[model samples]
Target: MLDEGFTYGGLLMGLAALVLWIRLALRAFPSVETMIARYQDEFVVPEARSHGELGRIAACATAMALTFSAIGYAIPD
Candidate 1:
């Protein structure tokens, strides 16, 4: 039971953190394109890539996190 609790707590914390991060990001960047344009050279990593590697990384992280959370929830304790 303690293990289950820990897993659930971790999942909750991760989800909460993700939500807070996304909220902060939204607040900081009301317009993604405008923000990108403002700090294109400085902020954009993996230089010269139009699609933007950072964006791809975020997408991959989101997918992996969701998949792990689902597995955590589905696995028997």
Candidate 2:
């Protein structure tokens, strides 16, 4: 049960990260600025429009790492 759940979860997360990386490499990632502006009615974009491509990538990687670590902490062995 442990390997079945945790390994599969890790695999799924890896695939998601791979897809995001492909989008970044192909310049297919959506406009961060436009998204922030579009959804201004709901909430706030913490980084604003000033976080450029590299910044966005860094943020994504950091976020993914954090979330991935969360899965580990959530499912104890």
Candidate 3:
């Protein structure tokens, strides 16, 4: 019973993290025009760079979520 609860909790948290990742990605790369504009400026594109960083963070969050869910599923009742 307790193990099942952990599994549910992990699934919920994982879903939340996945949603967050999607939101971050959508906000960062909304359109081609916006992306091109960000890079069109000089070699140094702060906005694009920041978005890339956010993407990395989002990826990390997703990874953590997966790990947590896996651990929860592996736990014994």
TM-score of each: 0.41, 0.39, 0.51
- Model 1 misplaced stretches (Cα beyond 4 Å): 1-51
Which RMSD does model 1 reach against the true structure? 7.8
The per-residue C-alpha lDDT of model 1 at residue 30 equals 39
Q: Is candidate 2 or candidate 3 better by TM-score?
A: 3
> In candidate 3, what are the lDDT values of residues 20-52, reduced to their tens digit?
778876776546765677678734334443557
Please provide, for model 1 over 1-77, each residue's C-alpha lDDT reduced to its tens digit, 9 standing for 90 to 100: 65566456657656765775575465544366655766765554432333355455556656656665676677787
User: In terms of lDDT, which candidate is stronger, 1 or 3?
Assistant: 3
lDDT of 1 at 12: 66
Candidate with better lDDT, 1 vs 2: 2
Candidate 2 lDDT by residue in tens digits, 1-77: 66445555655666766666665565544567757776786554444334367556755765665566567657757
By summed lDDT, the worst window of 10 consecutive residues in model 3 runs over 42-51
Q: Stretches of candidate 2 above 4 Å error?
A: 28-77
Comparing candidate 1 with candidate 3, which one achieves the higher TM-score?
3
The whole-model C-alpha lDDT of candidate 2 against the native structure comes to: 0.60
All candidates' lDDT scores? 0.59, 0.60, 0.69
